[model samples]
Target: MSIHVVLVHPEIHWNTGNAGRTCLATGATLHLIEPLGFSLDEAQVKRAGLDYWEHVDVRVWPSWEAFEAELPRLGQPYFFSTKATQLFWDAPLAPVEGTVLVFGRETGGLPAELHERYADRFVSLPILSERVRSLNLSTTVAIAVYEVLRQQR
Candidate 1:
């Protein structure tokens, strides 16, 4: 069984790196869609991922279109967005091998076009306090990954 994590237009290297580490820990694959805000080769990214960066199963796609073309073969996709009405736990996230969890950039979340197009596929984490805007990208990824793992267990 495998979990695929897709990060679209990610702007932070540290988040990406941490996400990579999470993916590595969970035996998940990481797919990154361009254009990225920071270089993958940067020291900050390596620092965040530590020496495990090299072991992460990461695939960098040229664009969303490029990645979308391969989506069917990858797995059933569930887009993560704060704007979604459905709670993630309520979603039919299963068959770990067939599940694909897609996340957006740190600053903007997913593109508005994506939100509109995949409205039915979107799922969200609960944010209890009104004072908080959103969780960190890496934190969100970690929680989502573990939730999927928890469900499988």
Candidate 2:
């Protein structure tokens, strides 16, 4: 079983950097969709102050379409969004070979079309407070991936 975390058009380096670390920590693969605001280059990533970038498993995609084309090849792609009706914990995620949890950019989340396109597979972290909108990219990924690990165990 594997958990792949896909970030669409991520704007920050640290979030991606930390996300990479998180993926590495949890035995997950990090897929980054491009048109990125920050650099993913080795030097640029180091500015985020993480020393072990070399060990991080990261893949860069040119666009969401391109990423989506190959996403299915990785496994089932599950969209993560606050707007989704389904909760992450409620979903049945086994440690299967083809399970991916996809996320959107920090400011602009998964586009409406993408969300609507994959509504059945969309999910979110349960927000107890009605006022809470969403979580930070890295934090969200952490929670989702940990939940996946929990399910796997």
Candidate 3:
């Protein structure tokens, strides 16, 4: 199953650029929901290199509501959160299948209610540092997305 990466209210350009590259490497679809932090053409993003950008498969959704409406209709499964009890390493992921791996903004992460609602589907990458609150946005997505691919394989 292909992993879909969703970023809600993303606020950085380089992070988005790195994420797109990761998706390209992993064969995942990158989805960005507005409002975004930088103009899509920001120069900082250009640093990630044009080659990866060319191969990156990305989808833009106008709003969160629009994404929610389309996700189920398209039969794409999703996992949301960084601190979820379920570990991504253990979650059932498949190769060549269509599933989604959703992430929130780097600043605050997902809303409490959204976390509660998707609790079952949520999967987290284990952190050795309780002192370290979270991971880099792109880093987290890369880790989780690959785990999904690993499981599926």
Candidate 4:
């Protein structure tokens, strides 16, 4: 059983590092689609990941097209976005192979094209406060991935 966490066009290294830590904890593979905002060697990133960076099974993609081309080999990917009408809990997150959870940039949710293409797979975490825009990227990934672990166990 494996869970795959994908961060597309991620802008913040700290979030990415933190997400990696979550992936490490959950036995999930971490895939990063590039044009990254910060270097992986940055001190802050290392700080966030701490001693666990070496343990993370991380893969880097050159672009969205490159990553999308390899999607078939990866497995069933679900897009997480604030715009989605479906709630994350509604998804059948069975502990299965090639289960990819894709998240977008911090400020912007996901590319409109992806949203349009995989609209049915998109799910959102409910935000109780009207003033908040969205949850932290790492926090979202942790929550979503854990849900998969919960269901599988």
lDDT top scorer: 1
Displacement of residue 117 (Cα, Å) in model 4 is 1.0
Error of 2 at 67 (Å): 1.6
TM-score for all models, in order of appearance: 0.94, 0.93, 0.86, 0.92
TM-score attained by model 2: 0.93
Candidate 1 per-residue C-alpha lDDT over 38-152 given as tens digits, one digit per residue, 9 for 90 to 100: 8877585655556888899999999999999999888789999989999999987776457899999998999999998899999999999999888999999999999888888
> In model 3, what is the error at residue 26, expressed in angstroms?
1.9
Candidate 4, 57-113: lDDT as tens digits? 999999999999988787788899999999989888663556889999998878999
Q: If the candidates were sorted by their lDDT against the true structure, best first, what order would they fall in? A: 1, 4, 2, 3
Which scores better on TM-score, 1 or 4? 1
Between 1 and 2, whose lDDT is larger? 1
Report the lDDT tens digits of candidate 3 across residue range 100-125. Answer: 77888889887687777777888777
- Candidate 3 whole-model C-alpha lDDT, 0 to 1: 0.77
Name the regions of candidate 4 deviating beyond 4 angstroms: 42-49
User: Candidate 1 — worst ten consecutive residues by lDDT sum?
Assistant: 41-50
Better of 1 and 3 by lDDT: 1
lDDT of 1: 0.90
